[model samples]
Target: MKNKKWFGLLFFAMFALLLAGCNFNSSEKSDDGTKKSGDEKDGEVAQVLNLSAPADVPTLDSTKAHDAIAFNVLNNVNEGLYRQDESNKSVPALAEKHEMNDDKTVHTFTIRDTTWSNGDPVTAADFEYAWKRVMKENGAYNYMIATAGVKNAEAIMNGEMDAEELGIKATGDNTLEVTLESPNPLFKTLLSFATFLPQNQKFVEEMGDQYALEAENILANGPFKLVSWTQEQGWEMEKNEDYWDTDNVKLEKVNVFVVKDPSSGANLYETGKIDRVKLTSALVDQYKDDKEFENVKDSGIVFLRFNHNNPVLKNVNVRKAINMAIDRNGLTDVILKDGSTPLYGVVAESFYFSPDDKDYRELNGDFNKGTPEEAQEYWEKALAELGQKEVEVSINIADSDEMKKVAEYLQAQLEDNLPGFKLEIKAVPFAQRLEIEKAVEYDLSLSTWGPDYSDPMTYLDMWVKGSSANRMDYHNPKLDALVVAARGETDLEKRYEMLLDIEKILLEEDAAVAPLYQRGSAVLLNEKVKGLVIHPSGADMSYKWAYIEE
Candidate 1:
């Protein structure tokens, strides 16, 4: 996990549609008298869809939400200017009509007539306020605004100008105009992203700090609204009858229960308490032959991030040695039996295709691959360079079952492959792990990144010196320059070539980060759950078009 010419909104939309939609149909059924749908409109088929989540919602605030779980929730509870259809293509939602200039520097949109769950009208001002607020606050993901090529966005982020000068405005009650510093082919794709989703400015101001903290505090303009949410327990959603496209929303309610452990989630599914569950390696083994077993591909990469500030890790050969030592093939084949695969480049496979119509991985073969012999050579050189025979390092990781197992495997691989290497694992809660990484106090950290939109820049730009996601204190001037050029380059081929060069520098030459594997999920979904679109990236899954076929 983890674009085109400056043609305009319609061109962008077409490109998005051509992208491989991640949806895959699967089969399962709960029929032993345990299947229950609380309420139904037809008195036959219940539209309520039950699911299991690896974690609870961290936050529902669209502007601030970062994790997949929270973004998934926000995606359902709110509508932005655009949304992904069942085909996982960008389509207009709140903004019914849109056009961009020939240079793709300016975009104008017509906000559709819609109301929030609280009965307030959804206005063009909502989008403006939300985006400006993001700049003014400069939160963790604020780089995204600048990434969209919004004019003066970086200046505003740097405090050189007010957020009001960030090149977006509500020109009329229903019209929004946005000016971009440069042409962005993926701009329309961002419209469907959670961060770009609009906010009711008046309501947010009224709630203050408590906004989006609970079900009652949040407002919905999409297919569903949060009916109730019990922290660490479960959350429930009901159809938003006030939604602009309510008729197309098939699911009346979606009940998601927090089940952190794969075994626990499987147990709930077996007991008929949940309809969908993800399988761990062991569960995948057991359920491989089951009718409900569906191994879905994911566009996320689990990688090891080296803190460049660390004296030991600062040695490029040491980073390369670490990269070479790990047996990613074995890790994915055995440790992650849910179809995860070894990833050699920063950008995961099946994620981004270039303007020339070649997959990023297909275009750039394995870049940083190394054998055990190579690892030993790099290790010896690193030791001589640092005047050290051995070093002890700790890897910070989230204590999820999958991550813990992977960490253990990595620990064994490093300690065995590189003689005198002492690796320590410090596994903590997911939230705590994030805080630790954000502080840049860890020597090494294992992290996973899902793409926001299908583009090489999504993965390449994170290591651009001062990006918020660059928590490893890693920066390469050459890589930074390439990223900037890639972002602003209007020539698609040149931009794509820059992406290739950036990946070469980051993954091969500098070894800025060690990519481990591309993650895949083995899920058991009830066959009756129709129209569920599991995207490769951006918010994980969508229930807007999902419904219980029972």
Candidate 2:
């Protein structure tokens, strides 16, 4: 689960980072696919738009979705209680307005009269049904247990309490009330997230196991609906005319292609086949001078996750040696070529965890960045303890151009820095990589996590013992205690401090996962496309407010 927190990032295998060009300011594409000078709104509203995506969406079911591909599509096709506006503010969406009780433990929402793409009226019961469904025992939704702040949610998911007893009710057709176990400051903002989005009860039941498997099986109430989904190839979305805000939606159709090749995506953009394409590091130098080039800042971390169950990786000295041996500076500055910074800890600098505006990373200080001498010391000690003069480790990564380069870089770094070490690289498709990680079938897996929300806990909580996202099999009861303490603490200052300590234990002591770099993308976009939501957290991108000009 990239998002165990409301602002969670994705973690899987292979080219895990959404490494591409950054956010765009302005530029336009001519008919021949070349760049042209143009204003924000150069012509009349265009009915069709084309874009390139890195991969195909694995699932469309909001409850089961855990990747950027699925979430990006869901962001446009499903309306939540609130939606993140272009400025990243939580603005009213399905719920016209909401009010919190005195203690902030209970909230009442006044939902607007809306209709799904299939013309069924959206109702409060739909949201209630959706929430309960995800809370069912072993429902496998990434964020269900993470949302235990909702009263009885944990108990229901644990099967100790019935889903019907969860603290959510439809006081009226247009009225929805939710009671929380405690006051969560991020609850409203969490509503804007895809995992918390509404689903149609009647429609879901009708489709049963087939729900959201394809275009025809899904129901949408957002600005657009999934009209066609071709697995691996691409998908198409059309504006939902039944949407309450149809008048504001400019593009009638959105054509998205799953272009896994960076060079292919770049060519598509140059030829006017796609309005936006993520740039690979190999092509960043070529496009860096282009006016349309965008170096968008990302709020995520890329790391090397060790499967602790592996006999070799289970050794603390071995894990520490691997973590220190890598040259993160070289990777970020030279290999990535984007603005990504080397991370010494799991938490990114973008997060301000304390009330005094102190960054969590700074608080934890730097961990071991291995010099040749230091790495040798740890490696020798590790081998001596394991009774082996040499070792071989396998790494699993996504089969993208950028990630392939990353795996190669690591292979070179580790083999050169640590003696008696041989490395094997496995490059597989993005979806297959995720399956391998979930099954804990690899020795070393390159992973990335985007903050599910703005809080530092989003980054820190992933490593806690027994967490759904903690596929590493790494556990420290001491670190787990800090996480639990932070969650239950009402005082902001104390909570933030606890989080800082937790990160220290994870990176400095246990080396549960080796820090790689903060995730960011260098992207190219047509200036004619306006109002695309490029957020720092949550879903990587959203097109709900986007429109194209002629």
Candidate 3:
């Protein structure tokens, strides 16, 4: 409750701003004159695909990118050794073939001969450099916790040892070997993450800290090479002629624009300026009858995170009560009309490491369906323990139109469900919200999580001790112990059991965070656009296979 009063004041200030005016208009031009009829004319480049995202690119550095926008951009510019297909099966990308030792402690990969966009050979040393840099930099990346193969990675990251002592090594120019302290069943899946992506060591050193700050400093080893980036305008990528699998590549160019306003995004798509745009609630009804509307299950999940370090929210009963009070179904149905499904757990239902399993659902049962009576019971208990006659809670949220609706709904629900309790809502810009969350400046805040890798541990390990993403300061010794045990377990069944146990503790006892709903994206795409692949992880635009119809 330390910052509760300040949070309340900020909430009112934001609400006043919202009342002043909210307008979403499109400034992009229509592309009616550029439309073609059938197939691409000989020697002509394929169609120029225009795509828009709700958020701008957060960071170009793979190690620092923790959001969807940056991941989408990285997909066009970088490739991991392995790729996770739609079915969650691991397939080769930079690695043509691989073999594991008997004990599974060592993995040998046959690196495909590839060149960076700058024409430099992509060697095993690149991977070694990236792995060590992430551990040494100790930035915002959580790779060490997600990928358990690197020996002493945690200690090295915590300043206990030099990064050079890390276990990954290059056997030869084309061969690479990684030594893990113990067997990791999901090692291949973890490689799909950007944090594990290889970097050009020479380029990074030459550029110093500004290596990935712009399109010119970074080099691409993937299907597309970043050609240009216009801040707040858009980013463009062209096919890499030197890509190993260039024959299979489809699209020639991909243009991604930052269209935070849904109405404007829809307008841009309708006018043919953009190939695809995400739909908002206000426009969903309008586009429901349009044949071009396409909806897919989004892999992102939204939740409420409490600042456990705060004096008021530190109480277990208060957290549990708040979680019980939320009506997730209503939030999804009324507030977010973009086809999101209420989640009973943190992981998306479609997400998987192996083809047949959903890591989170198999472990933790669906999220708790909130009830007023249940919330009231917990609220009374919390009040008694705190010896307070009245309670007031403040929540911080993103200033997006959809998010504001959700926040207002929560404020009403909490006040009506729990007597003698008052609620305040603060809406700030997306970047500002992130800054405040990092500072731990609010009692409660709305946050989201998207898959960083294919494993359940990607979502579960965020709250592990001393993790940068653990903004809530939620510490559980048993949970921490299970996470460690699961990381080293080679047996699939045992590893799963450990993960399931951790999820059970989090949902049943710890209640460290509340699961809201799994997000779904609705896009408006021009009929001419083809070969577009939407991965749940939001990486891999797959534009190489796309061509414009003449």
Whole-model lDDT for model 2 versus the true structure? Answer: 0.78
Off by over 4 Å in 1: 1-43
In order of lDDT, best first, we have 1, 2, 3
Worst 10 residues of 1 by lDDT: 19-28
Candidate 1 per-residue lDDT over residues 1-550, each given as its tens digit: 0023344445534422322121111122436644443334466766777786777677788777778888889889888998888787878888889998888899999999889888888998999999988877776678888888899987887778998898999999899999999888878887788888889888999999999988899999989998888786678888999998889888777877766777666765764557788888978878899887888778888999998899999999998898989989899888889989899987889868988689999888886688988999999999999999889999999988999999999999999999989999999888778889889989999998988876778888888877778999888888877786777888888888998999898877888888899889898877677888888767788888887775
lDDT of 2 at 36: 44
TM-score on alpha carbons, each prediction:
0.92, 0.90, 0.88
Can you give the lDDT of residue 548 in candidate 3? 57
Q: Report lDDT per candidate.
A: 0.83, 0.78, 0.74
Clashes of 3: 16
User: How accurate locally is residue 123 in candidate 1, as Cα lDDT from 0 to 100?
Assistant: 92
User: Least accurate stretch of 10 residues (summed lDDT) in model 2?
Assistant: 15-24
RMSD of each: 10.2, 7.8, 7.3
Task: Please give the lDDT score at residue 173 for candidate 1.
Answer: 86
**Residue-by-residue lDDT tens digits, candidate 2, 1-550:** 4455333222211112222121112234556756542233455544566776788888888787777778788988888888888888777888887999899889899999988888888888888877777766344343433443788875665558887888889899989999988887667677777777778887888898998988899988988888877777677788888888889887677777778888777766775557788888889999999988999768878889899999999999998899879988899899998778888887888655578877677777788777878988898999999999889989999888878888999999999999889999999988888888878899999887877766787777777665657877889999877876776678988878888889889877888888888877898987767777787767777776777654
